[model samples]
Target: ISLLQDEHELARIVADMPWSKIDVNGLREQETRIRRQIERIENDPELGQLQTELKQLNQQATAENRNQYQAEDDLDKAQHAVQAEQAWLDAYGNDDFDDATLSSMVSNLLADAYENCFGASVRAQDRPKLIAGLFDHESETPFHTRALRNIVRIARTRIQEIDARSNQLRADTERIMDDYLNNHSTDDNTVMASVEDYRYFLDELDELNMLVTRAATDEEYANSVKKLYMSFQQLNRALRTDEENIKEQLNRINSMLKGQQFGPQGGRLSLDVTFSPIDRQFETTLSRILSKLEDWTRNASDNPTETRNAFNNCETFVNRLHNELDKIHDTNGIKAYGARNLDPRVRSSFYAIVHHDNAPDERISSTGGKSGGALQELTSFVYGAALIYLLGGDLTARPTYTTLFLDEALIKADGRYTKRALAVLPRLGFQIIVSAPESKTAEILNVANRAYVAYKDPSTDNSYLQELDSETITQDETQPTTAPAKPTTEA
Candidate 1:
C-alpha cells in the first residue's frame, strides 16, 4: 500500500510539473508533408524524371563552366596588360625611363597581338615612323606610346564584352535550374497518369535538389534542423506541464469524493417535493372549514345531523392531518426541520406549529404550511432518491429494498389519482406498501405484487388471515363488490 501511494504521489508530482507549449499544428503539417512526399515518390514518377533532366543539365553546365573559365582567363590576361600600361603612364610623369626599356615593354605588350594593335594605337601619319623605330628598337616616337595606350583600352573593352557574355550564360542557366527546383519543392503538382507526363515532376525535383544544395552551402539546412529540435523540446515541456495540471485536478476531485468539510457545517441533505391535485384540494377544503368555523362558533346549530356533519368534517380533516404529518415525516420535511434545528417530533403534531406572539390585530403566522398528505410523501420519496444520487450510493452500494409503508394513506383518492401517485414509486426506486380500506383495494390490487384480506369467521368466532390471489381479486373487482369496512394489508 505504501509503495502504491508513493507511486501515486510521484505520478501526481509529475503531472503537476509546469511544461511548455508546443506547435501541434506545425508538427501535424510537417507530418502531412512528409507523408505526401513519400506517397509522391512511391506512386508518382516525377522526381525520377526530374533527376534525369538534372543529370543532363549537369553535363551541359560542366561544358559551359569550362568555356566560362577560358573566357575568364582571357579577361584576366587583358586586364593585366591594361594595368601594366596605366602603371607605366603614371610613372612616366614622375620619372623618365630610357628608350630601350620603354621599347622593350611595348614590344612585350604587343607581342601576341596582330598588326591591328599598332595600327589602332598610332596615327596613320606616325604609323610608319613608329613601326621603323620599333624595328630598329627605337622609342623616340610619342605617337607610338599613345597608340599603345589606345590598343590597351580596346583590349580591355573587348575582354569586358566576353566576360559579360559568359556571365549572362551562367546566370541564365542558374536561373533555369533555380526555377525548376523551386517549383518542385514549393509548388504542389497534380499526380499524372502517364510516365511521359511526369517530365514536369522531374523538372521540379531537379530544381528542388539545386535548392537543397544552396541551402546546404549557406547553413540554412542546419538552422531548420535546430528549429525542429527546439520545437520538440517545447512540446516535451508542455507535456510535463499539462500532466502536472491534470494531477492537481485529480487530487482536488479525489478530495471532494472523500467529502471535504466546509465551515462548521457538518453535511448537506437533499430534498425532493412532489405536489399533487389532492393536496391542493385538501388545502382549499381546510381553508373553507376555517372560514366557516368562525360563523359556526358565533351561532352553534342544534340540529344533530348538522353536528354529525361537523364531526365527520372534523374527522376527515384530522385523518388528512395524520396523513400529511406522516408524509412530512417520511419525506424531506424531517430533514428540513433538522436543518433549521427544529424538533421534528414537536413540529409533526399540528398542521403547522403556529407562533402566537403577535396581537389579534396582527396577522397569524406559522413555521410550516398545510401542504401535506400525498404531496409531502411523494416529495419526501423524491428527496430520498435525490439524496441517494447525490451521495453516489446508487453507484457504490445500492439499497436492498427501497420500500415505504403508508398506513391508511390516500383513502379519498380516486382510482386514477391513486394509480398515478403509485406509478412514480417504482421510478424513484420505492415499493410503497399502503394499508387502505377495501374501497381502495381495487386500485391497490391493480398495482400491488400481492395482497391480503382479513376476515372474522362467524362459526369459529375467530379472526383469520387469507392470502388473496390476483385472479380472484380481478374477478371480484369487475363485479363491483362492496368493500369491507376494515383496511386491507398491502405490500
Candidate 2:
C-alpha cells in the first residue's frame, strides 16, 4: 500500500512536471508503463508481490541503464524541460487561455511537439473516468452517442414510477410542440423556445422518471433526480411523433441514399423538396460511399492497367461524394453535432438555479394585457434549472433550492405545503427561510448554521432598513452538535 501510494503520487508529480526541459522521449514509454503496472498491482494481488520482486530488478536495470545513457541524453533533458514548464504553468494559473495572452501561452505550452507534450493533467482521482470518457467520446458525436447510450440504461432503471399523470403531461407537451408548434403554427414569435426545447425536456423526463421508479441506492442522487424531474415538468414539450428519433434519422438517411437520382449537370443528385423529414438519408449515403472508396485499392487487381483505372474511378467517386456532403446545408445554417455546449454564463461556480421560479409558462408576449404571471414564474424556473445544471446535478432535478426566502408565499402556503417543502429542502440540501408574522423562519433558523434579521428603525428621524447578522447558537450544552454545511466546490 505504501509503495503503491508513493508511486501514484510520484506519477502525478512526474505527469505534472514540465516536459520542455526534459527533452528525452526514450524513457516516456517506461514511465507510462510503470504507472500502469502500479495501478494493475491493486487489481492483481499476485502482480503486487511481483512488483516487490521487480523493485530490486528495476534498481539494477537503472544502474545498467546509465551505461547506454549517453551524454546530453534526451530523456534527462525532457525531465528538466517538463519541470521548468511546470513552474511556468504554475506562475500562469496553469491556463493562460485568454485572447491577448493565449496564443503566446499556447505556443509556449505546445513547444515540445516532438514529445507530444500536452499541458493537461489527469489527476490521480480523475484518471479512470477521464480515460473512459475520452474513449466513449472518441468519435465526432462527442458526448451525444455516450449520452444516448446512457439515456437508455438510465431510463430502464427508472421506468416504473412514470405514472399516468406524468406520462399524460409529457404526451401533452410533446403534442403541442410537434404537430401544433405549441398550438401556434401561424405565429412564430408567439412561441418562446422551439421544438428542440420539448425534445430536450422529454429526454430529461424520461431519464428522471426511470430513476424515480427504483429506490435510489444513494439518497443524494435520488433527491437530485426528483428535483430535476419536477423542474423538467416546467419545460416545453415537443411531444415526439414516435419514440425513436435515432431510428427516424437512420431511416431517412437510408431512404435518401436510395433516392440519389443521377443524371443532369455533372450528375447532380437534386434533393426532393419533400425531403424535409428525411434529411439524414443524404448524409448517411455520402458517408457510406466515402467509407467503401477507402477499400477500393485493397481488392485483388484484375490486370495492373485495369486495376489502376478502377482505383482512379473509385477515387473520383469518393471525392465527388465528399464534395456533395460538404454542400449539404440546413436552412438555419445548422450542422450535424452532438449536444455538449458548455456556455459559461449559463453556469456559476456551485449554484444551478432553476428557471425564475414558476411552473412552465408558455406565454408569447409581454405586451399582451392578459398575459399570465406563469411565464414569468416559468422563466425563473428555467433559470433555476440552469442553476441546477451549473451546480452539477441533472437539469431535470433540483439541487439545494430549499434555501428559499419565501417572504409572502409562506403566509399563503399552509402547514402541509410548508411541511412538504421543508421536507424536500433537507433532501435536496437546502435551507429555508420564511418571513412570517409567526416564528416559522425563526423556528427553522434555530436548526440552521447562521441566520439574519432586517428591520427599519423608525424611531430615528431618518428611517433606514438595516440587517442584523445572526448566528445559530446551541441551546443545549450536553448534546453533540452537527457540523454546518460548507459551500460546495466546483467539479
Candidate 3:
C-alpha cells in the first residue's frame, strides 16, 4: 500500500509542469496530433489505436499487480478524489452513500489513478503537508503502513535542491558569457577587464549554487535557496529597469510633437497630436485635433488662412526632429508599416507623402474641402511611420529592442483601408522585435526572428504590464485613452 501510494504521488507531481504551460489551444493541438498519429486498427498501422489501447491495458495490468501490496498512500489520495466526485454525483442524483459503497468507489478510483499515472500518482495519504496537488497524501506509507513519506520527501527535496543548483550554474554561465561579449572591446586592457568582471560574477553564482546543493538537508537548502532567489529577483528587476528612460524620452518627444499646432478651423494639413502611451486606448485630445485637421482639410473655407501657415511651419520642425531621432535608433522591426509607400489607397499614398514632403503646412491646403481625410490619416501615419522607421533595422543586431509597440494606431480607418495600410509594413525594411499585431496574419511570425506579447493584468486598477516570458518590464501604468471631451462630428 505504501509503495502504491508513493507511485500515485509521483504521478501527480509529474503532471505539474505540462499543465501550467499548456492552455486550451496547446492541449487541443496535442490531442489532435495524437489523434492523427494513431492509425485505425483496420489500417494495420505501425502505431495505431490498438497500440494505444494495448499500452493502456499493459499499464492497468501492472497496476493490478501492485494492488495486492495495498499501496495505501496512492489509494488514499485516489480515494479522496473519488469520494469527492462520488459525493457530488450522489448529491446530484439524489442518492446516499454507505461505507462499503464509499470504500469501493475510493478503491476503484485509486486503481484508475495507478493505471493512468503509471502507479506513481500522489494520493490522499500525503495530506500531511497539504502539498496542494490532487494526489498529495497525508501520511507517507499506504502500501503496508511504513513511514515512507518522510524518507521519499527527504530524497526528493535533496534532488530538487541539486536541480536548482545545476540550473543556477547554467544561468551563471550564460550571464558570464553575455557580459564578456557585451563588454568586449578593441582595446586589450578593456577586454581583459571585462573578461575578469564576467569571470568574477560567474564564480560568485557558482559558489552560491554549490552551497545550496551541498546543504545538509532539504530544509537548509530551501532556506539558502530563498536568499539566492531573492537575489535573482533583484537582478532581474534591475536589468529590466536599466536604461529604460529612452522610451520615456521618446514619449516626451511625442508629447511635444503632439503639442505642435496644425491649422486652426480652415487649413490644408493641420496636425495637433494628443500624446499617449503605446498602450493608451485613444487620444481624445489628439482625436479632436485630428477632427479639426480633417475638417480644415475638408473645409478649407472654414479654416483661418494664417492657421494653415502656422501648422505647416510647425510640421517642418516636427519632421526634422523625427528624422534626427530616426537616425539614433534602428526601427527595422516595423519595416512593414512603411513598405509599399506609393500604394493606391489614399491613406497609404498620403502617408508616403509625409515621408518626403517635410515642408510647412502653408503650402499644403484643403481649401473648399479638397484635402479630404488626408489630414487625420497623416497625423497617425507620421507617428506610426516614425515608430516604424526608427525600430532597430538589423534583425540580427544584439542588444537591439526585442519588441515594437503602438496602441490604437488604426483608429478611424475602414477595414479595406486598414488592410491596405498594413500590407505596406512588410516591405518597409527590418523586423528585429515583435510588438505590433498585424491584421489576421500569423504569417508575420514566420519572418520574425522573435516576437513578444505584452498586456496588463486585469486584477488591479493599477495596470501591471507583464510580458509572456515571465518578466515584469515596466511599472503599473494605465493605457492612455481619448479624453471624453474630444468630439469628431463628421456629419
Candidate 4:
C-alpha cells in the first residue's frame, strides 16, 4: 500500500510536469542519428567544401536580415514624410491647385507669400525665381521671413496709430457736441440739437451772408435803395388812387342823400369820411424817403455832393421805415408794404348830418340824445342814398326801378317819419318791399303799394306767403282780413 501510494504521488507529479508526455525513445534515436550523420560528414572528402558553402549561406542570411530591417525603416520614414506633405498641402493649397502641377503649386505659394508680405501680387515668371531664392541659402534676398516679420510689425504700428487717432477724434466730437448743447440749451433745459435746427441756422447764416455781400459795395447798395424807393412810390400812388376812389364814392352817396327829405322839417343827410395814418412814424419815414428820392432824382447827375446827401438821407429814411414796419402788428400794414392794399391805413368815419331849413345842422352820430323815431328816419335816408350811390351809376341819367327789401325796418318810427322814410327809397328809384309785424302793419302799409302776409301751418310746421292788395288794408286792421286758400308761394 505504501509503494502504491508513492506511485500515485509520482503519477500526479508527472501529470503536473510541463514535458511529461515526451517520447524518450524517439528522442534517443534522433540523437544517435544526428551524431552518425555528423561523423559521416566530418570524415567524408566533400565536407570542407560543404562546410564552406554552409558558412557562406549563413553570412548571406545575416546580411539579408540587416537589409530587410533597413528597408522597413526607410519605408516608415517615407510614409511619415508623405503624411507631413499631405498635411502641409491641406493647410495651404487652394481648390484652384487641385489638378495643378508641382511647379504651379510652388509658384502659387511664392506669389501668395509675396502678396501677403508686400501687399501686391507678383508676376507668374517672377514667382518661381522668388520661391527659389526664398529657399536658397546663397541668395542675397534670402531674408523673406524677416521681411514678413517686418511687414507684420509695420501693420501693427499703423493699426495702433489709427486706433489712437480714432480715439482722439471721438473725444473731440463728444466735447464739441457737449459744448454746442450747453450753448443752445433752452429755458426748459432742452437742446435744439436736431439736424433740421442746424440746417435752419445754416440757412439763416447763408441769407445774412448773401445780404452782406449784396450790400458790400456802394453801387450795389445804391441800386437796392433805388428799387425800394421806386416800390414805395408805386405803393403810395396806388394807395392815394384808392383813397380818391373811396372819396368819390362817398361824394356820390352824399349827393344822393342831399336830394332826400327826412322828418317833418325835411332834413338832408351826408356821410363824412376822414383820413388818418395808422402808423404816424411809418408815414413820416415814408414821406421823408419820397422827398429824398425826388431830390436824388433831380440833382443826382448835376451835383455829386447833393446826390450823396440825398442818398444818405434816403437810406436813413428807409432804415427808419423798416423799423417802423417791424413794429406794425396789423396784417393790413404788412400787406401795404407789399403793395397789396387790403386795408387802407386811412380810417374813414361816416356821419349822417341833418341840414334843416328851420333848425341848426345836427350830426346823426349823437343818437343817444335823439328820439328812436328820429334816428330811424335819419338811418333810412342814409341807407337809401347809399343804395342809389351803388346802383345809380351816373346820377344825371334817368333812374331805373331797383328793388330794396327791408325786414321789420322803420318799426320804431312814428307814422309821419315812417311814411317819409319809406318814400325816400322810392324817390331814389328803389321799389321798397317792407316785412313788418302786425303791430306795425298800418304804419308800413301807409306807403306800401303792395303787401304780403306770411302764415305757418301748425300741423305741418311749414310757412307760406299770401299777397294782398294795398287798397284792401285799413289802419284799424292789424291781421290780414283774408288769406288765399292755398299759399301764393312758400315763404
Winning model by TM-score: 4
> How accurate locally is residue 216 in candidate 3, as Cα lDDT from 0 to 100?
50
Candidate 2 or 4, higher TM-score? 4
Local distance difference test, per candidate?
A: 0.53, 0.43, 0.43, 0.67
**TM-scores for all predictions:** 0.23, 0.20, 0.17, 0.44
Q: Which of 2 and 4 is ahead in lDDT? A: 4
Candidate 2 TM-score versus the reference: 0.20
Report how far residue 141 has shifted in candidate 2, in Å.
Answer: 56
Global CA lDDT computed for model 2: 0.43
Runs of candidate 1 with Cα error greater than 4 angstroms are: 1-377, 383-397, 458-461, 474-491
> Model 1 over residues 120-232: C-alpha lDDT tens digits?
55677554444334333355545456657777886677679888997887677666666766667445545433334457878787667768684333233333333433443
Candidate 1: give its CA RMSD in angstroms. Answer: 51.3
Any runs in candidate 3 off by more than 4 Å, and if so which?
Answer: 1-250, 255-259, 263-491
lDDT of 4 by residue, 16-89 (tens): 87885777799799999999999998999798889999999999999999999999997985666566556545
